[model samples]
Target: MTTETRPPAAPPRVDTSRRTRAPLHLGWWLAAAVIGLTLLNIGSVVVRSPNLDWSVVWEYFLSTDVLAGLARTVELTAIAMACGIVGGVILAVMRLSPVPVVSWAAKSYVWFFRGTPLLVHILFWYNLAALVPAIAVEIPFGPTLFEVDTNDLITPLLAAVIALGLNEAAYMAEVVRGGLLSVDPGQTEAAKALGMTHRQTLRRVVVPQALRVVIPPTGNQVISMLKASALVSVTSTPELLYSVQVIYNNNFKTIPLLVVASAWYLIVTSVLYVVQHHLERRFSRGTGRG
Candidate 1:
């Protein structure tokens, strides 16, 4: 039809000024509320319990014996880690050697140490006198050069150190090997292209870079070693847990003494965490994670 047609009137506009709201996340809120209440209840109970004896905890928290034990624990951690680092480096290099016998020897060492229980290792070292009776330095086909009774040579403290250190070495060898492996092959080739020898490339290029990957785990190992020092108490080497045990045995205030030990552990571990954080940050520089 020729009749003028006006566009159909626009449909009546719907009001969208009031948009639908999102759900309130009631389930998550409820769960958080329940968790908060549970934690609060537990805290209240722990704080108010008559059996806890907070005063006794404070009494022995920094006693001389406990302090000495803490020092021994730190000493063990330091010595064991030093031994582990040196031994681990040697084993890692041997494991990566071109000679099959060398590699196999390293592998065997790691396998034997890692597979056995550390407790047994500690006990074995402590009782080494029973097995070998004596330690001697001798010429294979000639006269003995030196001899010392095993018991005399391996005192309880020495036994603990040797056991902990050797055990730690097996684990550290794997750690060091993994770190070395993390370095790019291209970097080694580049170092060789610049006329670097194998040792030179490792010492100058590979190790420095590998430290970035190696340090964090090494720090963790130190913390673990600190805690593990407690096991040395079996050898009657006084460390943190053992010191606490001696006190509780005499006074029979077991829980409070245990609390003291636990408190010290928490404090020390917290300090280690801080140190580890700083070390990680120092090494992680230039990497975005830093």
Candidate 2:
């Protein structure tokens, strides 16, 4: 061995084949097959349906009434979500307050609003004037600024806004609270160390940081709100779904008008998806999520 030695012989190469693995998954394949077949069956049924009326869908897609309804839907969504963001922020702040009364009131609001169905909320708003006949702007101890009938102030459209907005507030309150909670406690301490007041720290340091956590869920809520806005039809608001229903009620082209509504919703949702995607990309900079 000493006579034969040159440099130490290189160690034999280890085989890596044993490290490679891909077992056949019969269960996975079977599940995939079932899903594929189910999708195909549904597609076939849609293609063969007798009442689809794709033509009517196309014809009324941009009709005046339909467009107006779509506009109203957009308006409601904007107003509702805006109100939601504001009210949600307030409720979230209240929820985290040091005052027991404030915190309890916030908790109760979230509980009731989230617990009740949105449709009931909308209906109640529509009929709220029956419960409280008048609304006023007054200084509690000093002066009555003005007064008006609740029915006059809360039209069907206003009712829709109030209902959807307040209901959305409850859900959004949780979202906002979660986002705020996700912020590092260290950040708040650091802000305070810099002599920042609580409001200043929240507004300047906490809220901006928390928004990255909040935007995705808020966007999803907006989409859901869009769909839920249709429930306002129950209040006889002439928004998209209600408008479609009115048309179908007049003409007997029930499926066709419904198709129009569906098409519009699809278009709006697709636009929202694109917008949300861009927003996510914008916000996900350091996180590398899209």
Cα-based TM-score, every candidate: 0.87, 0.85
lDDT of 2 at 74: 92
Best by TM-score: 1
State in Å the error of residue 95, model 2.
0.9
The C-alpha stretches of model 2 lying farther than 4 A from their native spots are: 1-24, 136-145, 195-200, 288-290
**Tens-place lDDT digits, model 2, residues 1-290:** 35765798899999987886789699989999999999999988767888777777788888999999999999999999999999999999999999999999999999999999999989998999889999989997989999999999999999999999999999999999999999999999999999999999988989887988998999999999999999999988989999999988887899889878988989999999889888877877777563
- Model 1 residue pairs with clashes: none
All predictions: root-mean-square deviation over Cα?
8.1, 4.9
lDDT of 2 at 29: 94
lDDT to native, each model: 0.92, 0.92
Model 1: residue 148 alpha-carbon error in angstroms: 1.6
